[model samples]
Structures are given as C-alpha cells and as structure tokens.
Target chain A: MRFLKECKADATADLVYRVCPMHLLEPRELIKDLKQGQVLEILTDYDGALEDIPAWCAKNGQEFLGVGEDEEEDFYKLYIRKLH
Target chain B: MKRVYLDHAAATPVRREVLEAMLPYFSEFYGNPAAVYDLGAEIKEVLEEQRTQVARLIGARREEIVFTSSGAEANNLAIKGAALANQKKGRHLIVSAIEHHSVLNAARYLEKFHDFEVTFLPVDQYGLVDPQRLQKFLTPATVLVSIQHGSNEIGTIQNLAELAVVCRTQGVLFHTDAVATVGQVPVEVQTLPVDLLSLSGPALGAPKGVGALYFRDKLRLVPQIHGGIQENGRRGGTENVPAIVGLGQAAALVQGELDAKARHLSRLRDLLVAGLQERVPQVLYTGHPVQRLPGHASFCVEGIEGEALLFMLSRQGIYANTGSACASKALKTSPVLTALGIAPDVAQGSVVFTLSQDNQEDDVHYLLEQLPPAVERLRSFSPVWRKKMAAVAGA
Candidate 1:
C-alpha cells in the first residue's frame, strides 16, 4: 500500500457511512464525471474498500495514487487518478 | 349524529388523488426497483420522479430525500444515523425535552449502547425551545441537535430558523422533525438551515406507511438498516413503490393547495377555540396562541379527565385525542404538557384538536354544541370540581 503525505484530487466521493458495495459503486459513477488523468478522492469507513478500491482500480485501468494520511478523521481517504 | 374528526395529527384519510396515483404502482406497474429488466428500469424512473415531487414540496434536491416507512423511521434514521456517522467529531447530542418518542428514544439508544451523552433541552411554558438556552448547552463535544418543528399535542411551532442558526454557527448538525408542520404549513428547506428534516405521508393526506427524510447535500449518515444497495445503500430493503408514489402525489396536491388549505383549516380552528373558550369554564388553552400550526387547537379542561371527555365525545360521534395516541392509553400526564410546567392534574385534562382541510365549519359547530355539555356532565360528577366550586363560594 502506497502512502502519500499530501495529494490533491479533482473530485471526492464521500461514502463515509453509506453501506458496502456503495464504496465500490459510487466511485465508479463519480470517476466517470472526472476527466482522464484527474485525481478522485474516495472517503469511506468500510475497511474492505482499502483492498477493493486498489484492486478494482488495477482491473479497470485507473491509476491508484495511494492513500492519504489524516489523523483527525476516522475514515480512510483513498485517492485514485482516472486513466481512461 | 354528525361525526366530527378533529385528530388529523393522529391520522388522516388518504386523499383521492393520492390514492389514484398509488393504485397503478401496486398492481400494474409492480416491479422491483433494483432489478435490471425493463419492468424494473421503468419503476426505477418512477421512484426517482416521486423523489423529485417530495423534494419539491420542501424546496430540496431530489437526491437529498430518502423515502422511509414512516415518520418515526425517518426520525430514527436522522438521529441515530447522523449521530453514529459523526461520532468521530463528538459524542454529545442535544434534543428538546418535548420531542417525539422516536427522537427521544433514538437519542437514549445512542446514550445507552453507543456511549454517547445526550442533553434533553428544556422548553418554555408554551413548549418553545429558547435559542439562547440552547446555545448555553453547546460544547465542543456536541455533534448534533434535534428539535421538532411543531408540537403535535400542543400545537406550538418552534422558531426553528433561529434555533437551527445557533447550531449551524456553532458547527453542530441541526435536525428538525417536521412531521407536524410539513403539510399544514410551508416548510422550505432553503429558508431553514437545518441539516436534516423528517416528514410524514399521513400528515400530507397520504397513506400512513410512507414518510421521507431530507438531508442537506453531501451530509454523511451511517446506514441504520444494513443490506444491499437500496437508497444508494443508505437504507436497505426494496423500496415501497406504491407508498412512495402516494407520498409524492399527496405532496404535489398539498403544495398546490397549501395556502388555501391553511386558511380554511385555521378558520375552523379559530371557531372551535373561540367557542370552547366561551362555553367551557376554567379551560386553559395550551401552546402558543399564534405561533402554532394553522389548524391545531389544544386545551386543558379543569376537573375532568381527557379520557372521559373523549369517551363522551366519541359517544356523540365527535373524535379527538388526549395529546399523543400512544401515551393516551397509558393514562399518564403527558410529558409534553408537564415540560411546559403544567401540573399533573391539569395535564390529565389535555385535549388536542387538529383540523384538516376536509373539516368544515359545521363540524366545528357540532363540536362546540356537544363539548360544553360533556365537560359539564363530567365536572358535575367530580369531587375535585365540587371542592373547587365550594372554595370559590366560601371565598
């Protein structure tokens, strides 16, 4: 798992407390709105997203930009760059 | 005998237009909204259209509304969902003391199992939560505040915008249970800065099982019901298509006729209030006289139990309630009236009359004609009334 000190994203999908499969489904829909090569941040509390997101990104040909660290927030902030 | 129903707060007859709109969805257009086939896809579009209609009634975006089984469910979702989701920020929550059981119980549930601290904010004599007092209770640990927009028992409407602003400026989430106000008055989310609001379908002349919660855009709520991706995975289980359709139709119908309906109901309400006040001795009008629902009037008649009065009225084909339907059968003084500083004995006499557009002036006249004699009969049999009258005569 790659970690980043600070990463900027073009858009963010906040799936913090929304139930599972939503962690996967919403990002797919939201990333469609982002232009190619633009970064999208996904916020989720579901632990499964940590693995599913990166694996899904690899399968879908999107670039997994690694997770950002935020001590203040309880949820994980995973970043991805849309690669078309 | 003319049958008079002045308990719209308890329930209302589903409007004809709403029923007509809902019937097709149950039989002909019945399709699982989550299914991928043409039947399901078409129903999905219909569901979204209902979302849009419900949203339009409250000046909200279509995506912000989530249909629930009832207003109680919506209240649970708002209080528990928002609180659990934002627990990382704080563990403290605030709700008015006179809030519905759904909210009060949800807050209590959080406190009991989730280790969250809840403050039941006090209200004034008129059941109005004071904004200044609300601000005093806020701490950095306070994450959310739930206050009902109107009191179903007392007919008092809170100064929600002012109360909501205090929470907003303090960075705390504000939620209002608008089940009592949504259809009876104009409740535009654009004007009120609440993060969440709950409204009922029965309040809008729709079937009882339907309600909706409106959350401000991008507000995160932890799913209260766990399952597949229904309600965008916010709430699980297949959607109740027909009820949602009914709520939407009712919302649309009410929105078009709101102002006129308010005028009509309030006119009948005033007549009832005036007639009761003039005819009945020692009748205490409850709640704020002016800052109330357009069609609600509540009173407490001294030396008579509300239950006995209801029995008498029901015999005369006049129907009403003693505060809440759930609590009335418990034969206890209403906590709402007690919170307003009413004595327990007086609170036992609490009677609420909620009007709808369907209620006519003749209905009010019928109530006026029957109520005085009923109160007189009950008072005549009461030792308390005799003692009070004897004391007055001696004085």
Candidate 2:
C-alpha cells in the first residue's frame, strides 16, 4: 500500500489494494471531509466510480487524476489530488 | 384533548386477556417446557395447549408450528430455508414486488449470495399482484413462491389463498409472510392451501422478539438460525419464553374475537378514511380500497412529503407513519408503493394510517378536522402545488 510519493524514485510499480465503498457517506459529507493539497487514494467496490468520482471532484473543484476499475469484484481505485 | 395512534401495522399494545395469561408464567410456573421434571411437564402441557391454540387460529396442525425470535425470522426461515432445502429440485424463485422487505430482501439475498434465479412479479395500481403474471413466471426451475399476505405500507391484501393453490398445483413451495394480516384477519392455512406461513407477535398486541412459522405438511426445512436443539432444531437458540407465551395469549384473544374485532376495526377505519378523503383535497387512496386490512387508511397527500406529514402529525401527538416502508434514520420512499406502480410524486407523499380496536368515530372525525390545516400548511410549500393553485386562480 505504498503511495506514489512513497515509492523509490528508481523503481516503477503499481499497487493493487481493496477498499470498501463509501456509498453510505453522501457526497456532501465526502467533500467536507477532504482537504486542499492532500492526496486521496480511494478503493471502492463501486462500479459507477468512473463517472461518479470524476463528476463529484469536478463539481467540488478537486483534481481527478485517474481511475482503476474491477468488474469481477465490482470495485474501483480512484486517485484524486486536491487542488483547492 | 385529541391524540391518535394510527400505526397499528407497526404494533399494538397487549390485550388484557393476553397480559393476564402471561402473568402466571412469569411468577407462578416458571419452569422450562423441555425439562423432564413434573413442574416442567406442567409448563410443557400449557405450551402445547398454546401450540394447538395458535395452530387452530390458522387451521394448521399443532406439529407444524415452530416458534422463532421474530416475524422477520419466521419469514427468513420460511423463504430461505425452503429455497435452500429444495435447491436440488430447483434454484429459481418467484415473489411479488410489493412484498414486505423481510420477504423481498431475503429473496434478493438468495439471488445475490447464491445461484438462485429470482423473478419479482409486478403488482397493479392498487398493490395487488396479478395471478396471470405470477402464473406466467412460474417454471419448472421455480422452487418457491414468496408473497406477503397483506402489505404493511399500503394495506393491500394479496390473494395468497389463490396464489397458494397455484403453487400447489404447479409443485412449487409457497410461503406467505402474514405479519400484518395474521390474527387481525381470518387466516386458515389448511383452507388457504399455503405450504408455509409466517407470523409475528408484535402486530397482535404481544411484545416483540417472538414469531412463528407454520409448515402445512412434513416438508423439509433447513434450519436458518442454528446452534442449539431448540425449536425442534429447526430454529436454534434458547426460546424467548415470555414473549412466546404473550404471543400465544394474544392469538387466543384474536381467535375469540376474530370476526367481531375485524368488523369493528373496519368500521373505524372506514370512518377515518372517508372523513379524511372528504376533507383533504388531492388525496389519492392506496391499497385495494376494499380488500385491504381491516384497520388501514393509506393515502397520498398530493403536495406534502410523507416524512414531513409524519413529522408534523407526531408534533400534534397524532402518531401515524409513512408506514413500514420508512428506512433507517432518514426515511426512504415506500418500496411497496413504488412496486405498486405509484408515480414518485404520489409515492413520496404517501401516508399510512392503521387503526386499532380502540379507535373511535370521534377520534376519526377530530383527526379529519386536524388534518386539513396541517395538510394546508405543508401544501403551501410545495412548488408544484403552488404553481397549480396560482394557475387555477388566474384561469
């Protein structure tokens, strides 16, 4: 579970992790909990993350870097770098 | 001084006779029914008597009765237990979309967690399941058909007896969650032809934490809540004796007054329903209108949200509900209404009023009087209602 910054600069690796879907937490709650300049690595078993995460970040003025999806287990890996 | 309790579907207070029957069990003869001692045998005799009493209320053999922790458990046991036990025969199930969540969620779990195929048959505008639709969905792979006898939200009564006959002829297991309709209505399992029926105690004026499942014949049921040799090893764990006794007593009382009480409730229910409809505008009546539970008055106030109406009524000391479809903490719009083809506008604004034997005509009239003003206050805030009012005035 190494962050992108935590990895050795000389090494290239991708980390696979599993996280529970924050479906119970409304987006308003999620937006309030996040802060500026903090990197959020979320693991969610939510299929709609590709659309939901990016749309949510865009509405909240957060940067949506990339998304990883898992169809088998119905999960998602979303990377967000808070800009403001 | 006007107060109301229009949520009889949620619960009822224990009847005097029921409470009296339970008093001795607590103090006088507090012996385990399963023990071999003489006192225990006496307690066992009374328990068996209760078993027959409860069984007779539903026209089932005493041996078919097995008490459980709650109505929810009884439903789970009947639906899931039957499905799993008969999996070798088939892995498919059928049920009404308007079924209580206890049955609906159990079926959903079977589909999600297991390899069972589930077909949720749709209901009509009044929350009645069409027999033709159910018949069309039944296949050789269909192992069980689960439906609720009466809806807790809208109060529509399903034709379970007819549906049960359908399942019987087709060689599929039938389970009806009769939590809302049991005791209040004449439930004859033998005449009804249902294979399994679920009963809960709270609705019949007994305490919570007790219910029972009735299996008509010698059908195999895999134990759902397992651990001990209790409940014939079908539903394991120590018995909730006090509640069970209370439930038995309640059943006896219900059996004694079944016809008369039903008529009484219907009279009061109609009075409330008619008074409210005549007074309140844009009111949409729910359920089967006639074939519904004897005590329910379900309607949608055109403009006000169900939650808002419930909250306002609570403030007035008028305890009713948007009914059992309300979700955790923040309420959810009724799945039953949605399943019954109610538009979102009506479904979200729905309110359920379940009367009891105690409710009177004066109470119903006063409630009718109180409702118009409250509804007016809420309707004033609704954008749609406001716009419509403005347009009508201009016209």
Candidate 3:
C-alpha cells in the first residue's frame, strides 16, 4: 500500500461510520461529479476499504493517489485521482 | 353518552388526505427503493420527495433528514447516533430530566455500556430548563445535549433558542425532541439554532410508525440499525413507502393549516382551563401558563388518583391521559412531575389533555362538565380526601 505525507483533494466523501458497500458505492457516485485529474478523498473507518479501494481504482481505470495520514487515527483518508 | 377524545399526544387519527396519498404506495408502487430497475427508481424518487416535504416543514435541507420507524427511534438515532460518532471529542452528555423515556433511556444505555457520563439536567417548577443553568453544566468534555421542544405530559415548551445558543457558543451539539411541537407550532430550524431535531408522523395526522430526524448538514452519526445503504447509510431497512407518503401528505396539509389550527386549539384550551379551575377545588395547573403548547392543558387535582379519575371520565365517554401513555400505565408517580419538585401525592393526580384540530369547542365543554364531577366522585371514595377535609375543618 502506498502512503503519502500530505495530499489535497477536490472533494471528500465522509463514510466514517457507514457500513461496507457504502464505502464503495458513495465514492463511485461522488467521483462522477469530479473532472479528470481532480483528486477525490474517501474517509472511512471500514478496514476493508484499504484493499478494496485500491483494487477498485485499478479496475475502474482511476489513479489511486494512496492514503494520507490522519492526525486522530480514527479513520483512513484514501485519495483517488479521476483518470477517465 | 357524549364521546370526547382529548389524547392527541398519545395518538391521532390519520387525516383523510394523508391516507389517500398513501394508498397507492402499499400495492401499486410497492418497489424496493434500492433496486436498479425502473420500478425501484420511481419509488426512490417518491421517497426523496417525502424527505423534501419533511425537511421543508422544519426549514432544513432535504439531505439533512433521515427517516426512521417512529419518534422514539428518531430520538434514539439523534442521541445514541450523534454521541457515538462524536465520542472522540468527549464521553459526556446532558439531557433534561423531563424528556420522554426514549431520550432518557438512550442516554442511560450509553452511560451503562459505553463508559460515558450523563447529566440528567433538572428543570424549574414550570418544566422550563433555564438556559443559564444549562450553561453551567457544560464542560470541555460535553459532546451533546438533548432537550425536548415541548412536553407531551406537562404542556411546557422549552425556550429552545436560548438553550441551543448556549451549546452553540460552547461548540457542543444540541438536539431537541420536537414530537410535540412540530405540527402544533412553527418549528423552523433556521430560527431555532439546534443541530438535531426529532419529529413523528403520528403527531401531525400521519399514520404511526414513521418519523424523521433532522441532523445539520455534514453531521456524522453511527447507524443504530445496521443494514445496507438505506437512508443514505444513516438508518437501514426497506423504506416504509406508504407511511412515508402519509407523513409527507400530512406535513404539507399541516403547514398550510397550522396558524388557524393553533388559534382554534388555544381557544378551546383556555375555555377548558378556566372552567376546570372555576368548578374544581384544590386543582393545581401544571406547566407554564403562557409558554406551553397552545392546545395542551395539564393539572394535578389533590385528593384523587389520576388513574381512577381517568376511569371515571372514561365512563362518561371522555378519553384523556394521566401523563405519557407509557408512564401512566406503570401506575407510578411521573418522573416529570417529580423532577418539578411536586409532592408524590400531588403528582399521583397528574392529568393531561392534548387537543388537536379535530376537537371542537363542544368537546372542551363536555370534558369540563364531566371532569369536575368525576374528580368529586373519585375523591368521595378516598380516605385521603377525608383526611384533607378534616385538616381543613380543624384549621
């Protein structure tokens, strides 16, 4: 898994306490609103998102920008750059 | 026997317009809102429309409303949901002592299992939570405060704006259970300054089993009911389309009629209060005289039990409540009355009358006529009444 010191995104989808598939479903919907090359951040507490999001990015042809460190350590902040 | 129903706070008859609006959804439009097909898409649109209607009634954005099973569930979501999600900020919570059992119990659950400290805030004799007193309870660890907008049992409306502002200035979240106030009065969140609010469909002439919570935009809540992506992942379960449609229709109808309805209800309420005071001795009017719900009148009659008074009044074809329907059946002194510092004996006689638009002036007159004699008859059989009379005679 790639890690980044700092990353900025055009939009953020906060799915911190929401259930599993929502970690996948909401970002797919939210990323549609972003233009190519703009980064989208997904905040989630679900551990599975660490692997699923990276794989989903590869399958969907989007660039995975790696996870950014959160100071509180409560949730993961994963970033993706829309490639299409 | 003349029948008069004065228990709107316990339940209300669904309005005709609301029932009609809900009929088609039960069969013809019975499609899951989560499916990918056109049928599901159509049902999804209908659900969002209802969300919009419920949101507009409270001056909140459509996205801010999350539908739930009942007002109790909404309270659970607002209290437990918000608190759990924000626990990192603090493990402390505060709620008024006179809140509905739903709010009180939810807080207790957190304190018992989640290692949180909860403060059961006290209220004045009139059931008013003083804003200054609330401010003093705030700590750096305080995360949320839940106070009901109006009391279904006592007819008192909290000065929510003042209380909410205290929390706001301190950067703490504030929630109000508005089940008793939503359709009865104008409750625009834009002016109220609360972060969360709960409202029930039954209180506004919609069918029971449907309610909604309003959380400010971007507020995070841990889901109380775990399931798939329903209610935008805030609450889960197949949408109750028929009841939600009913709630929407009732909300729209009440929004237009609220002013006239409040005026009609208050007129009857004043008549009943005046008549009851004139004909009955040793009656104590409960809650605030002017700051209460417009259609609610509550009293404690000395020398009689409210349950027995209810039975006698029921025989006369009048339906009323001694307190909240749940607490009244327990046959114990109401915690609400006890919190207000009423003597246990006096609180035993607590009676509440909640009026709705359907009730007419004649209904109030009938209750006034039947209630005094009902109390008198109940007191005549009571040893307590004799003791009070003997003390009066000695004096």
Candidate 4:
C-alpha cells in the first residue's frame, strides 16, 4: 500500500501497468507486491473493484486504483503498477 | 445514430394523441367518477365511452371490459377466475408450456392451493402449439384452455381462431393472453371465436397500469380482486380514467394505422433480418417465417452468451433483449426458447429484437455493425465454445 502511494505521485512517470492474471492473485495481495515508484495493476472482472480498489487506496494512504473491461473475459487485463 | 430501441415489446412511448387525451383528465376532469355531481358524472361518462371504444376494438360488449392495473393482473384474473367459478364444472385447466409467468404461475397457484388439475401443452421447434394436442388434453373434467395469441419472446403468432373453434366445438371455454397482439395486430373476438381474452395498454401506446380482459356475455368469471363494486361490478376500484382514456385514443390510432404500421415494420424487419444473416454466420434465426409479428426478430448466435452480448450492445447504446423483455440481461435461460426444443447453449445465446415503426435502415446497419465483433470477442474467451471449436477442428 505504501509503494502504491509513491508511484501515483511520480510526476515524470508513465503508469507502469502490472496486470495480475485473473486467477493468480487477488487485487489487495497484488497491490502489496509493487515497489514505491512502480504501479500496481489488477486483473479483475468483478465490477466492485472499480470503486473498492480506489476507495481502499485512498483510506490506506495509497494511490493505486481502478479497473477497465474487455469483451473477452480473460483478456480483461486490469492495469495496475507500483507508483506510490 | 446514437442508439436504437428494439425493445418495443417491453413498453412503448405514449403517442401524441393519447398524451393529449390524458393530460386533461389528470387536471380538469380529475374528480372521482363515484360522485353524482356534474364534474364527476362527466368524467364517469368519458370513462364509460372509453370502455365502449376498448370493447369495439376487441369485438366484445362494453360491459365485458374489466380494466385492471396490468397484463399480469388481467391474466391472473382470467385463469384464477375460471378455475374457481367453474370448479363444479371440472377443475381441469390447460395452458401452453410457454405462457407468460402470469399464466403459468396462476395455474401453479390453482394447482397448489385450490384443488385444480393443470396440464401444460408443449410447443414444437418453431414455438407453435398444436391445436390437436390441446384437444387431446380436453377431457370431461376440462374447464378452460388458455394460450397466448402471440408469444412475447419467440414472436410466433398462434392461430387463435383455430384453437377457439376446437374449444368451442368441444364446449370448452377458451382464453388468450393477447397482450402482445391487441393493438399492433388485428384481434377480433367475434372472429377469433375465443370466449375470453386479455390485452394491455402499454404494449401499444397507452400508459402503463391499465389493461383489460374481454369476456363473452355468457362466460362467467369470478373477480380476482374484491373491493368496491366497480367496472360494472366485474372489477372493483376507481377507474383509471386517464389511462383508460389514453388506451381508447391509442386504440383508435392503431385501428387507423394498423396496416401502414404493419407494412413499415415488415419492411424494416426484413431489411434487418437480411442484413444480419448476410453479416453474421453461424447464427440461427428463430420464430415462424410467415406467421410472425412484423417487427420482431430473434436470433441464436452460435458461440456468445446472451447477457455478455447484451452488455456489449448496451455500451454501444443499442437496446435489445434475449427472450422476453421482462427476463433479459439476468442471464436466465428463456423458457419459451427451451420449450421449443432449443438446446441449452443456443437458448442461452438467443436474443430478441422487437422494433417499433420509428426504427429505420440506419438502426439495422448499426446493429449489423456492432453484433459480429461482439460475438467474436465473446467467443474468443468462452472456454465451452473454444473446446467445441477445437474438437471440430480436430474432426
């Protein structure tokens, strides 16, 4: 959660996207693996992640947040990386 | 260009004339019809006149028109009333396997709570029920036969006239849930020879919360809901004056434009069907070709799940359905399609489009543009489909 905070604040950085496989890791666990400047990406199809992840990051004093959908379920790569 | 409405079977926009007719009733003539004052009596007079208009549309007597809150209530009244009133006649009731939940559930209630025996007659591949099979179920204990005039999901138009004739010859009362057909298609109670019928206002251009049941003068049905003696004592409540008036005006409009609407919808539907078939391969078009509602199109795509496909279309601002308007997007398999002997995969992927007269060539093009990609994208990740494809490839 601490690393995600730094990555989101990095001004010169492009969003480093870390896409966890849908089955491999949960969003919270995956967010924990990122370095302070690297972004955290989550691959989740659960619609709740859109609001839950962002809200969790804000409360935990972290920056990693949000989701995107694909028509193909497995291809729905949630873009997350360690930033803050 | 932005979006198209192909869910007219769900509900329709109120017509300009119907809205005009209803606006005054909400304000100027808002007095209770039960009052004896001129203001109330005048509203009562208009309500009765509208009742007469509704009756004329269905070829029934004015007194036989019992207005209810909706199509489901009307259907419940028809099934339960006949079941209870004719209990002594015999408790045997027969209905189609693919009836709206209103009919099926009502029958279930009677079978469960009341001591009534219910038989559900099945449909064939095209969703058409055989009248002969219905006849076979009619024993001396048979009290009523209820079938839909047109299926909401499959769009197959049933031959009510033939079914009615068979029931009449057998001295059995017949009813039709004509909520899908009344205003859009020609429904003449006298010609159809049906003993009782149900129709909804919202299916055409009238407001929701208003529908009617048509019963022959001699046919007796107990009131499903008991309250104050209203609706000529057949149904009890303050009349939905504005909504009923709106229904009358809309029915008048339908009577005038029925042929034109039919022609326009048929042309648009054919255009859509031809374009979809040409664009999308491995898609099966369901519903009877000649005996179908003009604006209805239903298809079963080979590889995509319907809810996912519908969600994709929603993103593109195109509204349609898989099976009934009431049950789509919930990922529930359509009972109507399943009853037609469709397999689980095909039934799960079935989608229905019921267009209004206002839809055009652009809408068809838009759907054709969006659908194949949606199908391909959905198919790519579907494990069941991928496995089947791999097997086919190996074969």
lDDT of 3 by residue, B1-395 (tens): 78899998998999998998999998899999999999999999999999999998999999999999999999999999999999989999999999999999999999999999999999999999999999999999999999999999999999999999999999999999999999999999978899999999999999999999999988999999999889988888998999999998888889988899999999999999999999999999999999989999999999999999899888999999999999999999999999999999999999999998889988988888888878888899889989999999999
**How well docked is model 2, in DockQ terms?**
0.01
lDDT of 2 at B108: 91
Candidate 1 residue-wise lDDT at B87: 87
Q: What are the runs in model 1 whose C-alpha is more than 4 Å off?
A: none
List of clashing residue pairs for candidate 2: none
Candidates' TM-scores? Answer: 0.98, 0.80, 0.99, 0.81
- Per-residue lDDT over B255-359 for candidate 4, one digit per residue giving the tens place of the 0 to 100 score: 878889889888888988888889887788897877998888888987778888888998999998888766774568888888888888878888889988778
Count of clashing pairs, candidate 2 = 0
Write candidate 2's Cα lDDT for B72-123 as tens digits: 9999988888898778778999988877778888999999998899998888
TM-score ranking, best first: 3, 1, 4, 2
Task: Evaluate fnat for each of the predicted models and list the values in order.
Answer: 0.92, 0.00, 0.65, 0.00
Q: Which ten residues in a row have the lowest lDDT in candidate 4 chain B?
A: B226-235
Q: For model 3, what is the error of residue B283's alpha carbon versus the real structure, in angstroms, after optimal superposition?
A: 0.5
Which of the predicted structures, 2 or 3, would earn the higher TM-score when compared with the native? 3
Comparing 2 with 3 on lDDT, the higher-scoring candidate is 3
Better of 1 and 2 by DockQ: 1
Ranking by DockQ: 1, 3, 2, 4
Model 3 per-residue lDDT tens digits across residues A1-84: 889899988999999898888999999999999999999999999999999999999999999999997686799999999999
Worst 10 residues of 1 chain B by lDDT: B220-229
